[model samples]
Target: MTLLSIAGGIVDDSALSSMASNASTRKTFIDSSITIGGPYNFHGLDLDWEFSSTTTDMSNLVFRSLSYPAEAMENNLDWITVMAFDIGAPTWKPNLTEAPAALYNPFSEVSGDSEISSWIRAGFPARKIVFGLPYYGYAWKLKDANNHGFLAPANGADITADGALGYTHIRNRIIGQGGAITAFNYTFASDYCYNGTTWVGYDDVKSILAKILYAKGKGLLGYFTWRVGLDDNWTLSKTV
Candidate 1:
């Protein structure tokens, strides 16, 4: 009933301890879907994965999580969510526009998923493995900008606000705004509106649904989001 969500940004042990201290009353949960690097201390609460790099092998990440099972037990945390969004679109980067050629479809990578599952089987119970699904897609600048070198733009072609609308909201807003929707073979899904200057990039309902179904097929415990606020009309919860 109570889920602790962990994410990126600086978190200290005192904060986690406070949550664990009042665990019975607060029902605090850690969402670790976007954690990058940490064994961060939150009242002894184990750090969870945040947005990881494409280069991070899934097997290694699961091993890292398994390494802290004792600490998790001490903190009364029996569940661990295996952040798996990066597995879908390997090239997807929030701040970057163009994806590197090295990035490939994560679904096709057997070693990664197997390693993650193996780690879970060895370390935590099956019910503790919550998989992550993304509600947004990466957008790349067709042209170079600021010489950032493969850094993609943040607010591409989606509606509502730059990086504000969720996948569902983007679809609805596009339909409402009378914009054309198109799916690209390389990108999977996209929406564009002519603002008289440039085109943007974003994911559509099809892409989000694909991820959801994929998570279900993978026998994951549940699906989680990066942030509920980024969802349009609070659709993330509804989707879950």
Candidate 2:
């Protein structure tokens, strides 16, 4: 059956942090949520708190009275979605263009494989983990159009300030209009397309299928994307 879930959160996690800090407030929040969801016939509530970094913040999350111990999680939670992308960005590595979601990376432990392995090692069951994929990509402005390759010198972000582009935009605007040269980097297990100075690193149909196969091979619960609205006529979604 298709379950309807209500997700609540903003770009920041301060509100969630505050609500998690106190037991009474937390109980009230949960009760109020049920009350709100009852009439709407919602099946579940997903807390998209963005993140909670500090030890206190983390401790307070998911009902502090009963912390999310590994054993409790294994018993209570069906699965967890591991966000495995956003590994490289202009803000993180401004000097060079890099894959935002490389499956494997020789340079550092900053790839999807590393992230999933780390979680598995940390006691989270592999079968209870759903790997995450991105339906979006980051664009970098090549310092020299002729020098377009992985780790190529980049001036910085292109098109948008954040260099983010949805799959539709990349397909229609960049690939369609500019006739971008698309290539799959087998080394990183990532896909990229470039036209002139604009270079974008994202999962196309090829990479998405590869990642899904990888997740299956690793014995993951399944795979999911960050957002569905970014898909190009449901192309990527269909592939997944």
Candidate 3:
């Protein structure tokens, strides 16, 4: 059965109405959320709670309550896919330490912390933990053309989609057509593709494989991606 996962855990003013204030409302949401799938044989929900650090209400109330529904939903479905990307960034900007860097740095301090562990600590089962891989890179418009590497300063992301460029675009258009320099950081297990003044950070085949192996080692359920369409003809998908 094809299950369409819905995005959750976002507090756009409120998640299914003030879950913190109205305790009854929280249960109502939990009850009603399941009914959404009754008409259609959809698989499950993918809880993507992004940028919870941006606000206090997000961090406190949303943080305290967000996971309950996901744990509940997991029981109701065949599977659930949780987002596990955006764990690191090279944007220490303007500082000398910041330079051009990969979006998905497996060996970075943050990645080392392992959000997956946090979920398990929060009480989610590891077998249900479908880790995520990024099929895109974060781009930065350089503040100084020559100043580029891991943690380089930048004006900001150069492209739309939060300065993101997809893997397929990086492959066919940037590297293939523009002759970008593809370099790997062995220590960190990440990749950098620089086409002239523009620098992007993404996962290459090697980095993807490395992550998959790591996940397998941890006995993870499987892996998922933030995007599949953006991959080079689903090259990353096939490889994973």
lDDT of 1 by residue, 1-240 (tens): 433345353455444444444435234342332232234433334455443332222223332342444334424555555544333221334344432111123434432245456656555555556655455543333333333222334434222333333455444554456644344333332223222222334434444455556557766566566655566675555655
lDDT of each: 0.42, 0.83, 0.62
In model 2, state the lDDT of residue 10.
45
Give the TM-scores of the predictions, in the order they appear. Answer: 0.46, 0.90, 0.72
Off by over 4 Å in 3: 1-4, 8-11, 15-20, 51-82, 89-108, 117-125, 143-147
Give the top-scoring candidate (TM-score): 2
Order of candidates by lDDT, top first? 2, 3, 1
User: Which 10 residues in a row give candidate 1 its minimum summed lDDT?
Assistant: 98-107
Q: Which residue runs does candidate 1 get wrong by more than 4 Å?
A: 4-7, 10-77, 86-125, 144-169, 172-176, 184-203, 234-237
TM-score winner between candidates 2 and 3: 2
Cα distance off (Å), candidate 1, residue 38: 24
23-116 per-residue lDDT for model 3 (tens digits): 5775665566678866687655444444344344443434434344456545654444555555444343323222122323443545522566
lDDT of 3: 0.62
TM-score of candidate 1 against the unseen true structure: 0.46
Better of 1 and 3 by TM-score: 3
lDDT of 1: 0.42
